[model samples]
Target: MSLTSTEKCAAAEELIAGGKLEDAEFLLEQVLDSHPLNVTALNAKCGLLMRSGKMAEAKRLLQIASDIAPEDPVVLTNLANVALLENRIGDAIDSLEQAHGARPDYLAAILLLGQVHQMLGQRKEAAEWLTRASALQAEDPDVLAAGAAFELDQQNIVEARRLYEKAVETRPDHIRSLAGLARIRCLAGDFDKAVELAKKAHLLAPQDPESALVLAQVFFQSGALGDADKLIGRFKRRYADYAPIVLLGAEIRIAQGEVQQGLADVAAWFRKAPGDAARLVAFLKLLGKAGDWQRILDMCEKLPAEVRASDAVVSLQEEALLALGRTKEGWQSWARRRNLSGESPCPPVQVTLPPRAPLLDEMVLMRFVDAVARNGRLEVSGETQIPGMWERLSAAASVDWAREAAPDPQLLADLAARATLHAPENGGFRAYLAPEPGRRAMWEAALPSDGRPRVGVFWDARPPGLLIDHLQDALQDLNIHIISLQFDESRHQLRTWRGVLDAGVKLEGPGDLVNLVDCLDLVVGPDGVPLHVAGALGRRGIALLQENHEWYWAGSDRQSIWYPDVERIVLPIGPSWAGAKPALRETLERIVPALHLPVTT
Candidate 1:
């Protein structure tokens, strides 16, 4: 018996549900050939075309179906899908809303509307639609997965995990649910479980790049570099022009110790995406690390003015200038850069009278005077000399005191203006100081008669934690008596190194810093207050730096303008501190011989 048109349409729907897309397409075409206005046949054919990735043909058929059955919810929903694929978000929303109006219980349309709103970043509207869909079909795996995706986007990770788990339980082989779970696991630092779930998703849908990418990232984070490298290699071959894959490939190369090649890959990305400011900054940092001062300067010049004036860019520029031996130009550039921050200028205020006793306020006022004098603006009118302040400040600023008058009100105002212009945000007011007589006396009285060279060491900064013990171990092998200049909360870290080396002496407080710094043969540490103090005191020092160090340690050169007596050694990029051991050893080897010290080992 021959089937009727309606029966053929129902049979085609069944074929589609049974995964026989070709058979369904043939039956729908036969029906449509006879009944050109048949909504069911048109909708079915549109869905089949969509499933085959023929979006243009699917859109044409969906339009025909909508025209034939103006009130058909299924037809509207299919039309919405076509609109969405064409990037017509408003059209998609209108179609989905019309579908819901046509048949209020249309679960597919409700779910799609929710997903569309989510994609548009309308979180509140998306939640409303998703809540309605969930109420309508509480046990639907698709609904559960969609809800999980919303939760994930909102960063409600716990709820997302629960929803995804329920989805996978409902439909054990759901690829999206598995992938979602894998992503959550990866973020939670459970790489082992993340890899397992990601592998399962990849196995189920081998062509899906998301699952493969997730698996590769899991391997990378878990320190399985070989696995990540292999997977990334395959992805590069298969998805050669994929941007995310290319970026990950570059990172993987860097992790594998191909620093220059990896940097070149990043540079290629920068060339392709010139307008990405973050990427440009990252590229400049890599150039700085490679000691490519010319390239750093050239790239900074190419940047937009606003970007070029940014703190990171200006810092790199400063480094490049100083490295190129343009010290005067670099200092002037730094002064100008400091003035660009748009902060209100400091008010010209009169200096307050010094406190009768040697109080903290008096010391602060004295330091302020010292800063004023260093700027070459001090005009002392009276013979009330503040001990060593005038001579120290004048010497540090490289100005001759004989050419200038003593400190006065006008001089104080000029100092205030220059201080406001040149003072760093951290208040690093390059004030000159003679060693405190009292602290010097105590230190001299306690000095051991053995006459071993004293090296001052401090390690740690505000962020970017370092392996201080490794540094100490390297230093301990140098046959020198070490002195701990570490203070503040980080001094607690010293306990770990004490037993491994000779019990080195330590500074008692901040007061001892001046005398102690003046006492040391050399200071070595991460760029911080100790190094700054050593530099100010004219002591030779070595600064261990990460790749993206602060602006003060500008340039790739061994020397700094802020600390002319100090040299810098920068660690490799990517695994910066992790790769510092060899660099530190090599630098210390050169430095020890240059210092004319006997090598113990």
Candidate 2:
């Protein structure tokens, strides 16, 4: 007994609704044979195939559905979905645009189009579409939440909070909206509000790791590590079956300086779930620190072929091997990684220098400059993108030589032409210090001729939080009458210090900060505005860098060519917690002993 086309289609729909996907596909094919242009059957089958991860089949059915009903919104939206899933971003945009044009008030089409634009990095257009979508569906909690998240990502906290608040008002239990609000509050240093929202999110979605993670971040920010520890334990217990959450917990623990315990937990989790690539990469980097090189090499050997092929992991493997002195194999691995790093856009450098190295002469430095101009690409250096060969070479040379060669006019022209600069601080040259007054009285009053050596202290800068304790320790050991040029003196700030260095030390505000920097015999601090001021004032100082040399300092050696008067104390390349802190203390100990004056005591 053969069924009619309509009957077969209805049967397929029933089968699909009943969760019998294979049966639905079979029935749908039978129906399609009798009625090849059936839009309803085609659209339904397209949706089914898409849900089942059959992208090609879904696209074909969606195309057929579109051809059958040229003006149909549903068919066009499905086509757009298929295109987006296939990563045909431009095609997805076109299809969604047409769909939106056909049905101008279609909220889903507008939202999908906006998402595609956002993913393609067209945030401006995405925002426009999102705004229109919000107007069309003003009460949509998801739309409002997405808008809030985008604004938050843009660092517009006030706008993001407003949108997030609206989303919560519309649907109070919306997890994403709650999480967005919590993140914004956390960023704004309102940990109490952040904690409240995060707790509400966790209550709403008991099994969600995201809410728990947000809570952990808030706790970490507020220095409530014990609370974070307890919440993370709850998170692990609840989501013990998942791998990423466990790895994330380990990362948080390590961040709080429980390195051994964190590493052990991470290793245990990796043994259970070896298939997760991100976690695998993270653990490999961690092992690259102090773990047995043979163990890391063994792990590399057992890595899945696909993971081994990943450039990031491959580079890590090579660098680790090189650091461990497996030079021959390491070079081979490096060759592979160099290829994986892709071709350089800049020309090749072939300049040579004499074998004898010393304080760089003008001729040697010019050869360096010519080689760079010929070969190296100009880039913006910061705490992330370390300067390239040209900038690095310049940063390592004498300031007098570099100034003569790379003058403001030539450097500015080059930077403008190339859309980059040799050094980030070259243009404008805005030194943070007010120029010292010409009058002799200001100078005489500012500089104390005390035989005790008017030692200065500045214990403030932006860093990864751990370094602050190290800074405090270094300050404590100096045992001098130190004055703080403290910037973040407010109680509400994230990086607050409560007389950690010493109770006898005087904490100065912005005005006193400047005055004290003017008066001090020797200034010392991390990379902060005061450091810059001290350098410009020709005051000898030391910079305690949190990261390695290549990170932000931009030179291979400890001495800074940028600020020749200011010596640099960098954390060593190898991962020892004792390195940066102890090195600073020793440097301080050595210098303090040389001050031929009596101790304050």
Best by lDDT: 1
Q: Evaluate all candidate structures by whole-model CA lDDT and list the values in order.
A: 0.66, 0.57
Report the lDDT tens digits of candidate 2 across residue range 282-352.
67766644333456678888877988888767777665554443434554565444332222224222222
Inter-residue clash pairs, candidate 2 = none
Off by over 4 Å in 2: 1-136, 169-174, 229-247, 258-449, 460-479, 490-518, 535-538, 545-550, 554-557, 560-563, 570-582, 593-601
Best by TM-score: 2
